[model samples]
Target: MLSAYLLVSHGSRDPRPEIALQQLTELINQKQQSYSSSKKLVGLAYLETRPEPLHIQIKEFAHHAVLAGCDSLKIIPLFLLPGVHVMQEIPEEVALAQQAVGKDFNLELLPYIGSNPGLTKLLSQQMAEIITQAWVLIAHGSRRPGFQQPVETIAANIGAVAAYWSVAPSLEAQVEQLVAAGKEKIAILPYFLFAGGITDAIAQLTETLKLKFPAVTFQLAQPLGASAELADLIWDLMKE
Candidate 1:
């Protein structure tokens, strides 16, 4: 049976994340072309803040794939955590799409990209290049219980502390804690997929913190952008 791939991400008006996703998709398709001749039809869908709703995108892609003789479609979420979006929203949309497309096509939802163990190695590699007394992995926190565990686990694996943009133990608080512990030089790594408004906010906050704590040193790293390693991870998820 012919197979197709659909990548879903939290859409934004900033355009950077969407552009990054497109680049990643191009990289993935290029890699897949080396091993397959089926063209491996790939499409992108967004969860929110985009012009089209996710369900509409899913249906449109399903119809296109059906016309192209595709028998199955796999969806890979480009989110960092298994929060409400991963746990409830995407699945619900998929179910609705399935009903609209009928049984002629099979739809499968893959795990979120952040759950890949290879990401820990990636984060570790990024951290190793920087010299700092302390590090904080800052993510866009979720209010749902148990959602923070993955961020915390990743932080532990990288020997860094976990901080958030929206919740408790925020970037500022984490920096304060590090300062209290006599950690003057600290690095703040944004655990995001791309550089967008939130990542820009993180940079601004770092500047503010620098002014507040004039004696301390703060370094901010770039977000995980379109990289070869990330494309490999997406391909790995597809294989699974």
Candidate 2:
């Protein structure tokens, strides 16, 4: 049986998002306990732009797993895709960590959450519920716009399902266009976990727009938290 777990995420400069990841880790552990009490788990780190680098975090996590008598450690990257971070960065860091820890530990890397169809459906449902006029799904935009298409796809699916007036907008551009066009009611769904700086910036922008377009009501749908669907998603990943 697997004795411990480690969840690695692309850490945020905003501490609040990191705190949200910790909450998710606890939620995962709580669900895992149903299978066995012996398994122990903790969230480790990796920062795209932060103080604690990926390699250092992995070493610390390996120590925790080893000290906990873990023969096996499940490494789940809490990300959407198998992009640069997942393909190159995490694997390289994990390799270094494995060399130091030796072959006694079995390391299993689970697939990203974005690959889950169920989660995509859930996101669509959430988007449909929030928007009566139009939707601009706000994501943590990447330098590579191609990486953003999954979010657009999810938004399109929501529009298809609802048959509602919605357009997928990058947080930077279409938001202002919609406001200018007299879109009466618009919802900006932050496709993120926890309220942080991005959410704050979103609020400021929308509120400023609200002053200009008083008729347009901007509501933010909360991120998918520790919901049953998310819990089941994690459970399915563990089973794999």
Candidate 3:
């Protein structure tokens, strides 16, 4: 049987994030072995930071699978949502890759991580465990209005748990709303991996808000790193 797995994520030059992806792939492979199916798992990062763009990445992986005599390839996008990159850009790239590798290569793009209600529940539970007061689930907000629904869904699903007063918004809007509401204690949970420009900007914004809402305290939680639950989620996707 010709079969292989590819776990694709947003590429980062930072070694830490890339390393985490590698770890996630290893976990997937480990789980697959329990079912007596042995297939090579490859992890690819898509961005200029990496040598391969999405097209090249998928094609190269497909070529490797073909050479290895595998007939099927499954791609799992590690993004949090089905954004423009996931919906338009990645699919187009995959189509090109499929043509380049050969029509015979069976390839599939799995759903984005954020689409899973299980993962959303986990995110909400994680936030609830950490925050005893009002907080914002900070995400990489998009100007595209369509991008907001996934975040809204996650927030609503999380709210269903009734753990704490939680809201989802761009960092700026969240901060502003919290201050206006006279909330004294607040926290921000970054919905991203790795600290970068956006996280830094949120920090700066939070500092200013702290002074303005002196009664409100702020804390930032670490981004969801590679964890067993994530590893499980990947396995669940691949099984489907």
Best by TM-score: 1
Q: How close is candidate 3 to the true structure, as a TM-score?
A: 0.84
TM-score of each: 0.95, 0.79, 0.84
Task: Write out the backbone clash pairs for model 1.
Answer: none
How far residue 97's Cα lies from its native spot in candidate 2, in Å, is 1.4
Model 1: worst 10 consecutive residues (lDDT sum):
33-42
- Which runs in model 3 stand beyond 4 Å of their true positions? 33-37, 160-170
Cα lDDT of candidate 3 equals 0.69
Q: Write the per-residue lDDT of candidate 1 for residues 1-240, one digit (tens) a residue.
A: 567889999888998988899899989988888865556788999999867778789989988888888888899999988999999999999998888888888889998998899999988878888999999999999889987898899999999999999998799998998899999899999999999999999999999999999999889988889998898888887763
- Predicted candidate 2, C-alpha RMSD: 4.3
Best lDDT among the predictions, by candidate number: 1
lDDT of each: 0.89, 0.67, 0.69
Predictions ranked by lDDT, top down? 1, 3, 2
What is the C-alpha local distance difference test score of candidate 1?
Answer: 0.89
How far out, in Å, is residue 1 in model 2? 2.1
> What is candidate 2's lDDT per residue for 133-186, written digit by digit as tens?
777766665555466567667767666211111233444356567767776777
Better of 1 and 2 by lDDT: 1
The 10-residue segment of model 2 with minimum total lDDT is 160-169
